[model samples]
Target: MNFDLTEERQMLQDTLRRYLRDKYTTSVRNEIIDSDTGLSDSIWAELAELGVLGALFTEEQGGFGGAGFDIAVVFEELGRAGVVEPVLDSVLMGGRLLAAAGKSDMVEEVIAGALHLAVAHGEPGGRYDLDHVHTQADGDTLTGRKAVVMNAEAADHLIVSARDGDAIGLYLVAQGAPGLTIQGYPLLAGGRAAEVTLDKTPATPLGLTLADYEAVNTLALVAISAEALGAMETATALTKDYLMTRKQFGRPIGTFQALAHRMSDLLIELEQVRSAVINAAGNLEAHDRDLHLSATKNLIGRAGRLVAEEAIQMHGGIAMTQEYELAHIAKRIIMADHRFGDTDYHLERFIALSAA
Candidate 1:
């Protein structure tokens, strides 16, 4: 099996990389992070126009690319830039769920960037379980609290998970609906998420099952694992550059034998992360997708922490400064581990699946 990117994917990667490099400078990203909404509307609109949003869906869902590689390619670029936009929330989670539920109209709007959506599935104590929905749907109304809903403030609609009888169901709740309240706050990395409170809010039931949610959640795992890989790459590169330029006692610190050896170790670990991401992306649609994704995420969680901590240690106090690029990059790398599942969580899941 050849590991090379196909012509189309290579072009996509190059185009996205160039665009982000030109437009998403560290200063500009800091401004976006400091803004009221914790995101840049102009940048989001431009990304939509560039077909970045469309790339996450299939042709049938009004996108040219929706394959696993497509998601990996796009998100990796986003992560490398340390972009704070909620593309993963809006497009991958919300839009893909909508598409799977036959909500073509909503999916088209999302692809066009006209409709911002968020998936409100996680609860206060749910951890990372997709089926641990305590939100109850009484007929067409839902009443429960959704914790840490990303992009909830900017969303036009929310895709909520609720318990309907003995099965878990998805419900669509319009933004500003009666009995809905959202308290927004900034995330540690960048961007904003909200604590959503629903008190018997009217919602439209979506025709989707728990299994569908699981599949999309797995896709999200693939996306963030790839994102972590890009972040690790950037962190490693930044650290390498710092070591080569920052002098210590009239010599470049990179020339120190100990530091050089540590950098070498980081590079080896980064390559391991890359391999895991590749395996996860390749097995996205396979029968054993869950097994592979669990392994990939577990590896990502451990390796990402190592890269972040090592990068910070290698760079010294300067790495923690808010103005410095590595500060945010390291945060992203560490936070990616917490998104889908942590190292311990995925390790147990991988072991369980292996036994099965």
Candidate 2:
């Protein structure tokens, strides 16, 4: 199948790239990360106005695009820019779940970027099991802990997952509802996550009970894998530029045959990642979507590690410094392995799916 982007997608990509290139400067990003909220309201509003948030949903959900490529196109740009916005947590994951549950009206503020939410589904030992929820739902109250809730600190509402009479269900818990606690901190990458606790917190049922969980998880995997692909591309380009500019023995290190060969290997790895991402995106709605998603994530985790490690080593000490862009990009690529499922996790998952 052809991989060429459609004209609309191409325009969206170009527009997002230009916007980030001009506004998402290193200093500006640093400030945003260092801000009290750990996010920039102004930039968030700008992205909304530019129709970035609207692209992740469909017309039924008040968005223009909700396909795999739409999610991939938007996330890849965010990854390229190393944006710290909560688009993934809010629009892609939480918002989509809300829409699927017939709570599309609730997401209007989110689509407008005036609100943010997080899916508090992961538990301390869930280990990538989407339905392994220990959160107990007793009538209208929830009680349990959710670990690594991305964007939780800034969330206006949390899409919480709990066991509803032996079936996993989602609840909408307001941020400051009684007995709710959020301990937020920055992640190894640029953004923040929170360890959330709920003690009989009042919640509203969203009318979903993990029935469409695979679709949600697969969609997230597809989006994040695309994001990792973008990070790898950036890391590769940055390393290549450094090799050409940094001189060694009165010659550019990239001119050395051995180093050139290594760069060639990196290029090959990048192409492999790109192909895997494309395959996953294309097969997002297929009958064997789980197999394709697991395979894509497996390749991404492994390739991301190689790209991150090689980029750092090639750049040497400077790459380890926090101020450098390569360091952040590398961190994102490596940390991406921990999200959804790691290399080994996905490998096992793919095998199990294949066997079935």
Candidate 3:
């Protein structure tokens, strides 16, 4: 099978890579991470202007490219640059959910970067179950707590999941709605998330169901796995460069057979992750997408941890310093496993799906 990117995808990849390389340096990223908001408004706006946000949707949804490959191309670049923007929260999760709910207006705003949105589905102790929703909606009001809501502090509106009778429903709650409270905190991977509290908060019910959330959640899994691949790419590259340059006992440490073997192992692991991501991305619309996605995420979780740890160890103390690129890259790689689901979670899911 042909694995090469099409002309459009290749162009998109090249354009995004060049733009990020020129603008998103390690120093600039560090400042963004240290900032109170944990993101850059100017950079976010620029990315929108460059059509990065639009790439994640389809022409029917007011975007030119919404295919699986499009998401892979965009997020991989973002991860490689260690961008701290809330693209994953604002565009992939919130924007896609809005699109699924037929909320074209809100999706348009999201694509234009005029409105930021966060998905408030994860409740305390829910772990990674998409069907596990404890937040209840009584009429047009919601009362529940959402845990670790990414980009909640910056969101103009939140897409919250709530129990409505026997079904899980999606609700749109405006920021600062009555009885709504958001306690924002910086994430380890250079973005802001919040623990959101709602007490009889007014909300607008969306025309979406549990299935919609599950589909979007699966897409999110594919997106982040691709992001992990990009991060691993950067981390391993950084480690390879360090090994070749940093000398030990009058010779480059990488010249040692032991270190060379270790680096080769990392490269092999990275390629394995790359293959898994590709498989997941290609099968996004397949009937057996869950199996591939679960398998991909499981591999990413294990391989990402391996890549992050090995990269840091090979680089020594300097790799842990915040100023170094690998420090943040390593953090991004490790933290990615926790999103959607971790290694063990996906592994079990894959096994269950396979058995059925």
Lowest summed lDDT across 10 adjacent residues in model 1 is found at 207-216
RMSD for each model, in Å, please? 0.9, 1.0, 0.9
User: How would the candidate models be sorted by lDDT, starting from the highest?
Assistant: 1, 3, 2
On lDDT, the candidate that comes out on top is 1
Please report how far candidate 2 places residue 41 from its true position, in Å: 0.8
**What tens-digit string does per-residue lDDT give for candidate 2 at 1-356?**
67899998999999999999899987788888787567889999999898999998989899999889988999999998888777888778998888888886676887898888889999998888887899999999999999999989888899999997789888999989999999999887877898999999999988787876656888899899999999899999999999999998999999999889889989999999888888998998799988999899999998999889988888899998867888788988999898999999999999999999
List candidate 2 segments past 4 Å from native: none
Q: Give the alpha carbon lDDT tens digit for every residue of 43-108 in model 3.
A: 989889999999999999999898898999898998898888989888998999999888899889
Clash counts per candidate, in order, are: 0, 0, 0
List per-prediction Cα lDDT, in the order shown: 0.92, 0.89, 0.91
What's the C-alpha lDDT at position 21 in model 2?
A: 89
Query: Global CA lDDT of candidate 2, please?
Result: 0.89
Q: What are the models' TM-scores?
A: 0.98, 0.98, 0.98
Report the C-alpha displacement of residue 336, candidate 3, in angstroms.
Answer: 0.7
